[model samples]
Target: MLTLTENAAIAVKAVVAGTPDVQAAGIRIRGAEAPTAGFELTLAPQPEPADAVVEADGARVFLDSTAQAALDDQVLDAQMNEDGSVRFALAAQA
Candidate 1:
């Protein structure tokens, strides 16, 4: 399973909180195939039926099948940018 670092959880919660009228919202990850294979992230109101839900420090993240498999042994991290944007990164679990 994928794990979220403290910073990542805080960043995810901040993002979900900033979205208006959204209940149980979280960051959703799915496999993407644009040019090169990768993953896409978005805010989702709820997890999909087949999605894998990962929560840490009250932050939620929904991952699709492909993403779940790809990130199974990974850790999610986040960093705040100068312009108040959040940047997410993935790394192998230590």
Candidate 2:
């Protein structure tokens, strides 16, 4: 299963709060066509059918089966760059 770090959850929540009509919104993750390609992440108004729902730190995340499989045992983390931009990273569980 995929998991979000505290900072990632906080960031996701903040993003959802800023969007209109996003009370039901959550972070959605999908796998790319190529195995080596990076995953896609966005705020979705709702979960799609058969999506794997994961919750942490009062935030929700929805992932399709393929994404769930690809992110298995992975951790989602967020970091702030020196230029005041936020970057997300995926890493193996410790």
Candidate 3:
């Protein structure tokens, strides 16, 4: 199973709510691929920058059976340079 940071969850909820297109499209979670291990963090509308937002919730992200990988038991964070974008690297459940 996957979990979301409190702040990250809030942030994502807000973003999804605001994103008219995505909101209407319906955001979801899944694995990036068939991880040899377990999970492999994945999502639709591909989050830009792949991990770089504010608030711990900024790290909050979505995942599916496909996206969940053995992410070191936690969501690894990433960010972009030009803009402070946010995304999560979900590890599979061990």
List residue ranges in candidate 3 displaced over 4 A.
Answer: 21-27, 36-63, 68-84, 91-94
Per-residue lDDT over 26-63 for candidate 1, one digit per residue giving the tens place of the 0 to 100 score: 99999875526889999998899999999999899999
Query: Model 2, residue 41: displacement in angstroms?
Result: 1.1
TM-score computed on alpha carbons, candidate 1: 0.90
Q: Please identify model 1 stretches exceeding 4 Å from their true place.
A: 20-23, 33-36
**Which of candidates 1 and 2 is the stronger one according to TM-score?**
1
Q: Sorted on TM-score, highest at the top, how do the candidates line up? A: 1, 2, 3
Q: Model 3, 16-77: lDDT tens per residue?
A: 65554654222344444445554433334444444332224333344443443433256433
Question: Global lDDT of each model?
Answer: 0.91, 0.83, 0.43
- Candidate with better lDDT, 1 vs 2: 1
- The lDDT, on a scale of 0 to 1, for candidate 1 is 0.91
- Candidate 2 similarity to native, TM-score: 0.86
Candidates ranked by lDDT: 1, 2, 3
Enumerate residue pairs that collide in model 2. none
Model 1's number of clashes is: 0
Which candidate would rank higher by TM-score, 2 or 3? 2
User: Cα RMSD to native, each candidate?
Assistant: 1.9, 1.8, 8.2
> Candidate 1 — worst ten consecutive residues by lDDT sum?
16-25
